[model samples]
Target: MDITSLGGERAAPFEPTFASAAESYLKHGGEERYLAPIVAYFGDRPLKTIYPFDIKAMAEALYPSQSNATRNRQAVTPARAVLMHGYDRGWCNFIRVRRFKEEKPKRRKPATAVWLHAFSRQCDKDGLEHLAAIVLFMASTGARISEAIALRWDEVDLTARTALLLKTKTSTNSMRYLTDEVARRLRGLKEGNSSTDRVFRYSNRHSVNERIRAVCDRADIPYKPPHTCGRHTFASTAIELGMDVKTTMIAGDWRSSSVFLETYVTPRGTPGRVVADRMNVHDFGDI
Candidate 1:
């Protein structure tokens, strides 16, 4: 009977415009680049009034010539994140935007051992042992360029053949054991370097990649980016050498087996040769 007194007066509704929500999201450390187009598209629209179709339309209008992956990454994903941030603040209902369909990508070939060898030789010829060591470290340990660049001497244990990856893309520290070759190279670099110093002298990934591209060009080898030459090559080569999927995943710090298998474990260098040799298959006439 006294429900009105019990409930008291209803509070004013919390309504935030998309622009304000996005501004709040950015202030809370959200990526600015992704939210830029979304803000420009929706401007001061109420967060609650935006729908999935509106977001999709925004993506289409903003990125007409871009691929589905680009649209989703730059548009759909960021928009959803901002809306979710708003929902968390009780300014809007939670919303889900279906991503655009992406076609299956063609398999990328990892750098071969021969290609790496040539690349290393060129680096050595140019008196760039540090560059050689960088690629080798990446290829041996499946470290990303950023991880490799961020590695300090103290994080490495040559005796134990392990390095701690502190700046991993996964946002977790990872321990990666080095191959004997990588360990030897690290030892050589350690001689004159302080434990407090970074293992490589490079300041950024772009410079390293540019140096790699230059070396590849001089070596007359096809240039693959650091990701392809290092991490991708490590995974593919490890599996090709008969390392088990689980072991490879652990070594590469791949959290998802499906992603590792589908994206990184591509067959390379006459994959059917071993089977063909074992089966002894021949031409029909010869048979």
Candidate 2:
């Protein structure tokens, strides 16, 4: 019998080392951002040598310098991917990595009218029309920053007052109604750009967020996360305008009204105090 055919199973011709497998995955998988850190963690270790303790140590090491969320997302997720790649290629056994639990803090107050006015005025003063338009679009539509950035001219229908939004979590959200101001701002941005062009020229979410932060600093507003204000502002404003919760949920592309209520809605200045004000005085004779 030939040596190669000794066993019933034929092994892979070439088994990659741990580092090489990771490099291959990062190159072909197209997540180059994690390359440096993955290489630093794994070094020249062979595919079969890594253990769960090593993964735990790496997670613990990352916690001192990075948030638990970032540690798990950036380091742990990619590290697991590298291991999985090696396992799939028959170079190593399966190693399951545990991810960290990341619980975010709740917001005490949503973005208010005062912040919006101040931020918009600052954007106008800075002549950041693109940033201004983005702010306006988010404020009016309750759109996620990702959704707004990915919007194309072809998706906007000014005449019909509708927009075919792409990349929403649910495929059911392709069509959304647009406010006149939202439509107008979109038209303004589209004046010189082609239908195929993105509505905003923002190269990345970070750049847009940086601009918002700068405006917040200049306007003396407390900095919330980039789109926090816009998302909450749209919901709160709609509620204040007497829009029903169901309608507001649809407008915000929220899957559930409970999340919309918990995250976005808050008691206004005197809505609660005045609840019985009209009830007792306006119809006193009937009651």
Using TM-score, give the best candidate's number: 1
The TM-score between candidate 2 and the true structure equals 0.63
Instruction: Please report, in order, the local distance difference test score of every candidate based on alpha carbons.
Output: 0.89, 0.77
lDDT accuracy of residue 74 in candidate 2: 77
Evaluated at residue 198, the lDDT of candidate 2 is: 84
lDDT of 2 by residue, 116-226 (tens): 778778887998778877777787788878887887888888899777778686655557677776677667767888888887788678888988888889888888655
- TM-score of every candidate relative to the true structure: 0.82, 0.63
How many clashing pairs does model 2 include?
A: 0
Best by lDDT: 1
Give me the overall lDDT of model 1: 0.89
Model 1 lDDT per residue over 32-134, tens place: 7777878989999999999999999999999999999999999999999999999998898888889999988776689888998899899889999899998
